[model samples]
Target: MTDVPRAVDRLDDLVSLDTGEIDRTIFSDQEIFDLEMKNIFGRAWLFLCHDTQIPKRGDFFEAPMGSDNVLVVRQRDGSIRAFLNTCSHRGNAVCRAEEGNVRNFMCTYHGWTFGLDGELVGVPGKSIFYKDKLDLSKHPLRKVAQLDTYRGFVFATFDETAPPLEDYLGATGRLGLDMIAERGDMEAVPGVQKFTVHTNWKFTVDNVFDYYHPQITHMSAFSVGLIPAPPDDFVEGGAKSDTGANLEVPFLPTDLHNFVVVGEYGHAISGPDQESLEVTAGTEPFAWRHKPEVEARLGRHGGRVAGHPHIFPSTWVTTNAQLSLRVPRSPDVTEIWWFSFRDRNSSADEQAASLDSQIHFFGPAGMLEQEDGENWAQSTLQTKGLKSREIPQLLKMGLGTSEVVKEDGLAFMDAPINEHAQLWTYHAWREWLRNPSWEELRERTIPRDRY
Candidate 1:
């Protein structure tokens, strides 16, 4: 087996956009994972909790930022603040609960209490043990460098120099959120469904843009009528013909067009075009995108992006009115968190139906996720093998064939089912691991005339 090159010396060899091949070591290497935590997760703006999750003052939700856990708390004045969950004194988590309305966080370890704004307010033995030498104000929980929200979705970054939330999101990212926000007065559902997947987080992320897998990986879904089967003509044209002796599964039709939007900082939206989807489904599933106001906001191209939009590192915006965070725990372990949303004004029955769909689609209990988890787990496992890790993973479908059209602040393409977005993501990933300046990173990731 070939030995892997040092990360710093061979960043370009890790992922080659020109050849659409990625090194497998990136998925399982401990040193590379550590670098990612510092260069990507540490510096990038990470999604925390939705603003609606902690609406009331003193409400707090524990969220993971890289390896550290943080408490996203609502201030007394209705502002939001987030700080490390660890107590300043003893490094013990001050708040134990995942979420709740807390008066103040008092460390059970040493009785060091902190205010909602992350101010160190009380120390139990300050006067006796320290003889009043310890200052409460000197040791507040370490706060995040920057925190902001976009359309009620909260994000924070440890890098103080990271761009503002809007600037970071850019047009493609904003359009992804807008797809959900413009649906109505949307708010997060009460509970966030979270589960562990024994896979590298990158697999879960790139899978968002994979249109090729559903037809094969989700054949069981089609067999059960969970997803609409392709038209008879499409099946005849592409499916393997089996007499009564064998199982016949139709493939994703080749003629169907996919809309791919790739943006700065690894953000991308890739899947079937809304028009192509209507052609297959024989009904309009995305009528909301056609609404005058929503169309005006989404623009011509954005309105047709009936696909998964992924922000750099880990946020995934789904068309089913949900956001998923693929949190990287280690090289081989990832935590998937699903935050389902609903319009505040929707009817009870509509809300119930939405919740049911959300529950049955991609969370812990969801069949699709269960199927996907197994594949990702096995894929991650193979990356650890001596021979397998030496192999380059191929992503060559529709690679050099697509022309990128720049319009309305989006660099996109309408092509057949392809890996353009996936390739684009890896390209961006390589640049990010380089830890360039924000301007330099943007320059490196800027979409070219052809993807």
Candidate 2:
């Protein structure tokens, strides 16, 4: 394995929190990407398969953790464990299938078998060729340093020194998951809609907190009524087309308030308030937030966050009962996995409707995702150009203007549609790339009084 690059020496030059500008090269640099796989993905608690995906003994689901793949297995003892998928003997994959129930995994390259608990169980020529000298206990598939679940979502980390899962999540991250968990008896839908986008993973991640691009990037969805359109009076911003003429652009209503919550380790929630969304999309879509019990749990501020919640690095929790994992395959390629959720107790019609909305809104065939993917691909493509890459990407929408308000163990901001959350994410990203201690990282990512 390659050593983690000393990228922190130029972190400030790469991402300037003071100016809200970021070096484009960070998106395309191979060295930087390698550093991320080691320093960020290797350390942070990454979401794996949900508990619902593997409930029975011997059931397993494959998930990506940086450049490595892991098998999350339900053990015979009614517990879960995860380990690297590679065979210990020859480094070949022990399991070929993506997910299934099996008594044991036997490597195809060499019939070295492993039990559901990831213990080496059998070796074809052990007695004859090896003379029974090989130690199976010491040669079991390498296990993850830590594994835990929150609300049903399984997460794992390769860094044993990493904080406990809950501390890692903090208030903002917990609220993000709570947004989905509080809905009802939620469970992962049958299939995970996955596809690849030729874009830097960071582009997909930062876009979660972006509310400014929708009116323009997803105009097709709005035109087709897939996404609710801005009211007639809401037309305020304009963008210059290739012809240099100004094209009318619809913007969210000026008075619409956006709620932003930033927490340690780069977790954030940002977008229009639930009241603002209801004003435009109607309250029926967000009726769950209004429930007395749910509202009490989400609290006043969290109850209003009708937007995307991002757990630093890659996990994104969408308001529409879906969680997306932006798996970085390369500097310019990312595999997008959509895990849709539904209330198991709901009527079949309601469950079908939920899946339909999840599919149409943000998956391989989703209209909004298709539009966003184009922009992200193009943005990443520009970073490779000698001249274009020199230009700094801007996130100056609401820089240094919003005051963070602390309430009920949460630090948040209420403002018009802005890029505070995106900027916050980049700031946290810079700190994370430095590979500081957990205590240092927490201090660095703590929400500032102002942005």
Best by lDDT: 2
Q: How far is candidate 1 from the true structure (C-alpha RMSD, Å)?
A: 2.2
Clashes of 1: 0
Model 2: per-residue lDDT, tens digit, 293-336? 99999888788889999988899999898999999999999999
Q: What lDDT score belongs to each candidate, Candidate 1 first? A: 0.89, 0.91
Model 2 lDDT-worst window of ten: 246-255
Which stretches of model 1 miss by more than 4 angstroms?
Answer: 1-4, 235-247, 282-284
Cα RMSDs, all models: 2.2, 2.8
What's the lDDT for candidate 2?
0.91
